[model samples]
Target chain A: MSTIIDGLSLGSIYALIALGYTMVYGIAKMLNFAHGDIIMIGAYALFTMMNLTGSPIVAIITAIVVCTLLGIVIEKVAYKPLRGASPLAVLITAIGVSYLLQSVAQIIYGAKARPVTLFSLGTVKFGEVTLSLSALVTLIVCAVIMVGLTLFVKCTKIGRAMVAVSEDKAAAQLMGVNVNNIISITFAIGSCLAAFAAVFYLLQISATSPTLGSMPGIKAFTAAVIGGIGSIPGAMIGGILLGLIEKLCQSVTALSPYTTAIEFGILILILLVKPTGLLGRKRREKV
Target chain B: MSYMLETNNLGISFGGLKAVQDVNLKIEKNCLYGLIGPNGAGKTTLFNMLTGVYKPTTGSFSLDGENLTGLSQETINHKGIARTFQNIRLFNNMSVIRNVLVGLHNQPDFKCNPFVSMIHAKRHYENESNMRNRAKELLRIFDLEEERNNLACNLPYGKQRKLEIARALATNPKLLLLDEPAAGMNPQETAELMDTIRFIRDEFDLTVLLIEHDMSLVSGICDEITVLNFGTVLDHGSTRSVLANPEVIKAYLGD
Candidate 1:
């Protein structure tokens, strides 16, 4: 039961971050290289808010808003201009953005990790595992966002436009979708999701560092790729699978020290078994 | 009287190769117009320019007296021009019904409530029944209603072609462009496609411009034909006249 709870909790967080990766990839067909760093930025935002106002709610809100804007700006400045460029070029630019963000963060926030003191309002005991209230909140919040996002994508006009763009950009544009705007919107939403994930993460971990986004970002990315880069449900599945892999490795005999390695092994195995990921279909070419 | 569509000195080039150059043509509404040419005749190039894929480096195009130049395909599509590719491009992963729903994306957002909008219950379902009814009707026309629930990639080659046409028609365009719509079909499929084209033209009240290499196919269906060769219009007239023209024959048959 505790293992299940641990998997579900961590899985939810991974799912949130993975979604940002998946959504941006789906619409733009570009893997956002800076996405993990974007989460780090969110952590800094929360840090600043917590220091200045000392309110958790304000900190969370500021984090989401600031990260959201950062994401949109990143798209406008970095991703948008390279719209028609090769995927490799865009990828390199993403890496540049990630490093740039980290360096700038280090200059302002410094290299030292700060401990979060905002956990005074929380503790939840369920079964043998006493889940932190903040942790549960993080899990629920992510689920809510996912549910809302799924509805928006599946039902709305802009959502249809997004689907159309992903299906065929040229054709979608011919349908008057404002492709550039749609792409920007996708980035903004993805950034906001990552931002929320970052804040939730900081609340749970009670720590923030300039270079903190690296591991979470890599894990989320692995989740996205394992879920199928361009698939939403696949991201969710991938995140849960990744979380389970971590927990299972930690709990299993003698693999506790090799937790990260075991998780990576699962990702590699999934990639080798199905290049397109779990839910990704093998697209056929009409010859 | 306005020609339903016209191009004035239209030109496009890729790396100075000039795939299409200074081409002019016109079509009346509700006409089955044929654009015939041999390989590398730049027929598809001209279509690409008109559809806003490769923007024209020079000249202008108008549809129903509206300047179609400087328009993206979707904007032009919104202006009631819809098209199929020379090679089929379907939303391969999505089911056939969802594919058709995607076609009607621009049908104006109705029923704006958070619950329905969020869950897509009201907003998602709004006009869905009617859309499905229409989708069924289109499938029935193409004899594909039976396969409406299948993945587009799962369908047979002939049915895939039909699905493409049906999906495009779901957009309800005033002008329809068919690019080698029957390229990979058998004789029986070709004949059935001809009938389908005619049915669509009359049913949708559409003006069509087609690019086809099959003389029998084009001549069989088109009322007027324009032949292009080496990026220039070689001849334009009734299908019989264009087919009989020595220049069109030499360009096509090379003897």
Candidate 2:
């Protein structure tokens, strides 16, 4: 039961972050390799703000704003120029942007891990099971965000425009959707989610570093692929499943050491079975 | 005299090949004008230019005396021009109703207020229900209300074509551009489409420009027609006269 609670909290964090990856890929059709780095940037921003203000909410909001702005800036400066370019070229540019962000952070904060003062928001107990305060809070936040996001995507006009743009950019343009604005908005939303994920994520780990986002970022991306890269719900499902599997593996002494390898091995097996991933739509080419 | 849409010396080149050159058009308001040409005659290219999908190497166009020469597609759309594609580029994965909703979404009134919407505020629900009502009304007109929940890809081809036009109408366009709308339809469907086009024009009170290969449909439906061969206008006049012209006949059928 403890492992399940741990898995749910960790999985929600991954799910939140994976949503960024899936949304960027879905709408812009770019890998956005720098998405992970945004988490690190958010962490640093939150840490600095929290240290100065001693308010978690203010820090989280500031971090989210910073990440959103950075995401938009990076998209305008780096990705916009390469629109309609080859996937390889875009991929290379994304990797470059990722490195550039890491280098900038390294120069500013150095390589040492920064400690974050974790606050016990409150714990939840159900019968014999007791979950950490942070974990319960993280789960609640994730639930609210997920429900809100789903509603936003389904009920809002801009959200419908996003769907149209993702389906057929030219057609969407003909419908008077400002494709550039939509693209910028996609990045902003993704980055904002990343920042929110960072707050909950670092809460669990209680540390922030230049490289803090790397492991979780890769795992979330793996979650995205496992669920079906372009499907929003898929990312959430994949993240939770991955977290549960990893936690379960850790509980078993025999499999604990090889958890990462085992997780990746599952990815390989999944790819071999379904190239488009579980919920991924088969890309149809019009002749 | 003023025109709803006017183009002069509209031309484009790809490397050394002049795909379309020295094209001129003066489309009157609310006119059902047909643009007919042989395959590769740059009919679609002209549509692309007019819609801002491709920028002309040399030329300018105006809609209601407002210059639209260098505007983006979205801007052109905002300027009240909407179009359907040659290959029918409906959002296939989206439901029929959702497809129309996307078109209805561009209204300034429907602009997102994330904070209100996130909380499912009264205003958000009001705007959403209004948009839904409007989209459903459009579907009803296209006889697609019954299939509102079905994926666009699952719709029959004829229904898909109608849905495309229906979606275009949701944009509330002043000018409608239909590219090869009747291309794959059978004789019955083509005849039905001819009536539908006429009905839409009369009901919507809009100007229309269409590219088509069906001579009978063009002659039967269009008030005026322009004939093109090798990207240059061969003739332009009333549909009856253009179709009867020697050059237009030769363009369609070799001498």
Give the TM-score of each candidate.
0.91, 0.97
lDDT of 1 by residue, B1-255 (tens): 888889999988789697888888889989999998889999888878877887899899998999989777777877878788887777776677667667766654332433455555644565556667877888889888888889887988888878878877877788888899889887888888889899999988999999987767897999998888899889998999889888878887889
lDDT (Cα, tens digit) per residue for candidate 2, span A1-287: 87887788889889998999999999999999899899999999988988999998888889999999999999999999999999899999999999999989989988899988646566678898887878777888998898888877887877888889999999999888899999999999999999988898888888888888888899999999999998999899888878888888898999999999988898889989998878888998877
**Model 1 ranges with Cα > 4 A deviation:** A118-121, A126-129, A155-161, A248-254, A283-286, B109-116, B119-124, B127-134
Put down candidate 2 lDDT per residue, B90-184, tens digits, no spaces.
Answer: 99999999999999878776765867877778998898888889889888877889999999999999899999999999888889999988988
Return the TM-score for candidate 1, rounded to 2 decimals. 0.91
Q: Which stretches of candidate 2 lie over 4 Å from their true place?
A: A121-125
Candidate closest to the true structure, highest TM-score: 2
